[model samples]
Target: MTTIKNSPRNLAVTVLERINRQGAYSNLELNQVLKRHQLTVADKHLLTTLVYGTLQHQLSLEYWLQQFTRRKLDPWVKQLLLITLYQYHYLERVPAFAATNEAIEIAKWRGNAGIRKFVTGVLHAALKSGWPDFAAVSDPIQRISLTSSLPAWLVKQLAAEYDLATVAAIGQAINEPARLSIRVNRAKASLAQAQAQLAAEGVQTQPSHVAADGLIVQSGDLLGSQAFAQGIVTVQDESAMLAVESLAQVCDLSQATLVLDACSAPGGKTGQVAAALTKPASQVVALDIHDHKVKLIQKNMARLGLATRVSARQGDARQLAFLADGSLDAAVVDAPCSGLGLLRRKPEIRYQKTFRDSQRLHEIQLAILAAVAPKIKKGGIITYSTCTILKEENDQTVAAFLAAHPNFALEKTQTARALKADRAAKTLTILPSDYGSDGFFIATLKRVE
Candidate 1:
């Protein structure tokens, strides 16, 4: 596997095409391809930027390509050109000649001389003629959607939920790179100690509004360093950190207080909760259905130094077998849904997610809530959360769950977040806005029965 550092444009173009053709997640595919190719630090940064920028603004890039090429180009060729144009238009450091010349080289490999001419002509026109007047369009959704390259259905949903202006803001926000936030292992090192360690290595850090322990990384991939190896920090988003905080500060854990982390995979939340538990519990059943996911949770527990405190096991949220009536002191049902909310971080999601995915997920979410709500201990907290912004998955799903299960009650503790959050409801949503954050829906419920 080539590291991102020495990733060539031709290589990146091939990787990008593979992602589209194979229906692979862009981030996963990007890394897999980067590993085989050696790269310089500058090339690594450029490759990373080019890949993400192209994905982030794919729709917009394709918009111009369509104008330049009347013939329907192959998907691979189209993606290659878009990747080239991404650097040409958005990145000032990449010279225009370098971008176009590289595209022509890639085109020659992809097709005949005729295809090379097409690639040359399209990007060549882009450099000379410039972008279109997206603003002059009459339909606001069309304008913003084209400018941003978000799916039309998504734009309509956002526009209906938020005002046109706010939807436009979200579209713009999705184009920016989401900030990297790391959760410090206070158990392993204090925030000060961790920051100092990073500073020694030339990495920069800043506090975040998402969680008290959240740090916005200004430099270096902490994951690739000894700090992570030593269990000092873990990369997670700010919106995600809120899921653990919604537990309302568990001061006691030895009372055999059972906790269920539904949908706990890649184990970020499971580890976060264990870190905040503050006391060793008799059992914290960390569950995910996939066997590989169960292992990932275990790995995460090892990273955060919490493997001994939590049970990482495979169990579906919708069909938890051991969760009996009133059995859990707390249950975090991090339901699966159409992840429209994380579009900024995973730009390919915009293309993959569909309108009906939400409706289907809503059915699954409602089922999971119904089965799990009755299992919460009397007056114990049950937090339902998703890394998505759709109302169907957020308030609407919870409202439906409440209607189905009268035993559950809404707890308005969202307003009680650390000073940085200060959101309205204990049940609420978070949008990308200008913070370059992922959108999330979190609702804390109480088992009143």
Candidate 2:
């Protein structure tokens, strides 16, 4: 039974408007709104497009509409017109007449009966006028920033941090819906075997750039699919799989190596770490700071058929007590971060992430590294990683840790070879452009006893 409580377009418009005006998180509000109604797959897609697309190119739509509307309409009426214009101008499939008609129908709810005619007129005018060329403005950056719907500060930040072209690439990338990638449950089958099973089930996969366990899906909900329920696959991001692969590269599993997945949560990487080891392989201990997430880790381990050797524990990374100093094989400290690198997957992050989160998380990241470093096996590897792109959470935090602990040494990444990096740096910070993946930082270290 479908669970559509309201019309997808109407629900999406209401949600988008409320999110803009009330400062609600789009995804959260969208999910809450969805829960109130049961929608079909097509409606689901439409609603997603209406919400994310409206949010993504809102400034461009508004700027173009402003050039056509004569009288100042109410905010709601203006938003309806903009929504209609977004479809009319940008979306090729939606016919101009249907968009204008639907928008006018929605405008009838407003107090003025005359609003319908005004909306119809403005939409047609904008459609015929065909968007503005704001590049001729005095300051082109502001024009680009608003037209691209990116925060101006972020535009300057990325342009300075990366290059002008890369910043533009990033701005374009964040607006696209994130591609789905699936993680293979190695305890049950190899990635090939999992792919074969999914193929027979009418789902296809491509080999991921990183992680022997990673697969870029062709189609289907990886979690809801049969392969997933049968413990054949897991849903994960390509970059996150890279973080796990980085840890696996450092492991020498011949001996009884104790691998620590510190700060593990939602356990995708934890499952990968456990699956990285072979039979009678090294013991992998996945630890999370919270008790509830321990179950999540355990569940993932079970799904991957790793429950026998991989251990999931509820413990804080700041003060881990179960392991001895310098007595482990390897440690994957996938630290908690501001998640700046993942803005593409979660479009709302551009607005949600603040500098304060970085300042606060820096302390927690440093503390976790210090506490977990002592637990690493002497001369064994410890890979510190984060899903964030900011230098403060990546290199700067790492610099502080290295200064504090002389025993730890910085290591390099061999995978980010194509990154046109000229400046001298000690850490392996993989830019999205480097591997055609999301930006990430992975620093491999070894404890010199």
Candidate 3:
């Protein structure tokens, strides 16, 4: 087998090219490339910064590139220019000359003499011309779209639903990198025990203000550490942890209970629900749509020492004929969504998602809720959640479900520490700026009949 090049710039370019040309996800593609190559900590940081920065500011970069290039360029050439422009404008520590020289060198390695000259000319032209004036854009939505590097459609949708200032804040927040957080496995260890163990291994951490069991990883290779290997901790966003915590708060998990995680994969929230149960007699059933995802849930449960408490099954959540009606004590429908709230972690989603996609997801979300509604026993709780802030997938979906199923009503009393609940509507909407977590929405409903 041939070796893969791992230089910071080369890796960034390779990752960007794949994402741009092949429609690969930025995070997944970057992780795969990082695992294949040996990179120092600093190089790893640089690679991550380059890849994410280039993607985050892609629209703005192209706007600037237009000022210099009279004609369209090759896909690889455009990506390389974006990477260099990202460093030039955003990363102050990187000298301008270094950024320009690196691009020319990479061009020489990957292109012909004509391409090399083209690359050099573009960089020199960009340096001489300076940045584009986004303020000149007349349309408010268009201005925000170009300045924030978000899609114009997303900007318009957000503007329609929120004030201009709030939309601007949302756009700014999503561009920043997500904070790293880990949930302490209460089953295997206490928060103190996990923190001390991580400290002993030279990992710095601070308690998360939002999640009761979360700790912000200040500095460390959390995944590479023994704490992770031994399952003392699992990387999870505080907002997601809050969703499970909300379900646990409203439901009686103190006795023998059956909780179904209808769309669990990678098992983060399922593990949270299982670990939160105070009674050993209670069990959590985790289901996913694919065999690979079911295996992933099983693997995660095993790692966290929860294999005995959480059972993994492969099946579509929209069809639950295998389960008996009114059999479960509680259920969580963390429905699949457009993932608008997770843009900080998954920047590529902004470009890929459309208004029509959200409409389709709203239907799927309601279908999964309807399928699981009958599985919940009388007075049992069903938690509806998504890693998206769009009302179409959150509030409107719940409203539609309640309209169709009159026996179930929103549980109004459930509350979480960092989540803001609309008591009148009985739903919690957690914006990214709200508590420094992903944009998430949760609602607890009761089968009152």
Candidate 4:
């Protein structure tokens, strides 16, 4: 009685195939497909797990597929086997025979007899032979790459930055699911009040170690709860909150009148800055190149009750000719990068991004910093942040910007004690393995003319 059109497994196969072939974003694509199908909550969870799990372990699955068959596979067929293999190894509750039969049925429904036979042979062979041993991978990098399901190039990149042990730890941490964390709107409610409110709505949360205003969701539907609905809290990673928290500490926000959240969209950090600016006249301009994104920032600001203190506009961060020189007190540059830090939440990034991509982003990040540097008044601060943990995007970008602009000096980031930010280094890099949060790099720069 299983149908290809609506079955969770079948839908997962379709979604994964699209992601692989067309380079579709996993989260957005999965959400769109889920809306098209009328699935129960359990089925929806299954489909989501299948899509992410398959993508998370894609490299290992493809490597195992090579052992069973050397021939090239049609994209869908390969994706079907990959998800099936993922279920076999990771989903302990799903009976192996049940997963195999379902995969075979899907293959039969989608392909001809030859393809169906090929899929059946591969799945059966995999279940019988079991997964290959990581110990057999003689090279340490290869061993970690295969075992962790990270790309070999990425593994090498991390290994080069840190030791093999650290790379292994990061690889292991990224595969684990990211916990849902939200930043409480301090202007509207305190941490205890937010927790009590969320608890009243059946959502339990614990205080985050990374940021004072951040909370980690322990259970229940936070996004659907009244606390989130009323804008008392908004979904943001704990590491992300660290950027604004550090900015507030390193810079004197009280005496400041104007602040710029360059590259702001959906305005999480913009709202955070708005919350910090207590003065009625103090304003934060949130800028993004896309009009829709600017609208999104405005929408978020209204929801968070920060609209009065924020100005959402459409503009390029690289060109800030609108602002006069030395007119701003402080600025926050949350520059865009390869997003390697979000691999846990969006596993597709590992495959989609390249080394060249990070290098190119470094130039763009440096440009944004340079464009905003001359605009800040003497003794003002510019807090630069990126979601990526790459040196090229973080440390190197700062170094390049500092080299060109001698007036700006890197200032040590002051954050929560739990963060244990290195006092000697002026920048803070939070790896995914550090606290099971998204990887982020934050650096504060002081402009002393």
Which residue window of length 10 is worst by lDDT in model 3? Answer: 413-422
TM-score: model 1 vs. ground truth: 0.93
TM-score of each: 0.93, 0.86, 0.95, 0.98
Number of colliding residue pairs in each model: 15, 8, 0, 0
Say what the RMSD of model 3 is: 2.1
| Candidates' C-alpha lDDT | 0.79, 0.74, 0.87, 0.90
Residue 119, candidate 1: Cα error in Å is 1.9
Cα lDDT tens digits, model 4, 1-449, are 43676899999999999998899999999999999988888999999999999999988888888899888878888889999999989999999998998888888888888888888888889989998887888999899988888888999999999889999999999999999999999889999999999999999999998889999999998889878877899999999999989988877676678999999998999999998887769999899999999999998888898899998899999999999999899999999899998889999989998899999999999989989998999999999999998899999999999999999988888886536654467799999999999999999999989
In the predicted model 4, the residue pairs found to clash are none
How accurate locally is residue 330 in candidate 1, as Cα lDDT from 0 to 100?
86
- Which segments of candidate 2 are over 4 A away from where they belong? 1-5, 21-25, 62-82, 110-125, 137-140, 253-256, 278-283, 416-426, 434-436
Candidate 1 lDDT tens digits, 1-449: 53222347766777677767777887888888668766777776777787788888888888887777768768778877888878777888778897787778777876889889888878778888887788888988888888888888888998887788888888888887778888887668888998988877777899886677778999876777778788898888987887777665532333436788888888887776676565544567888889998988888888788888789887777786677878888878889988877888788888888879999999999998887877878878887899888888888999898898887788764523443345555576778883567887788788777
What local lDDT does model 4 show for residue 26?
Answer: 96
Model 2 lDDT per residue over 394-419, tens place: 88898899999998888664342223
Off by over 4 Å in 3: 1-6, 278-280, 421-425
Tell me each candidate's RMSD, in Å, in order: 2.7, 3.5, 2.1, 1.1
lDDT of 1 at 117: 88
lDDT, residue 99, model 1: 79
Question: Best by lDDT, which number?
Answer: 4
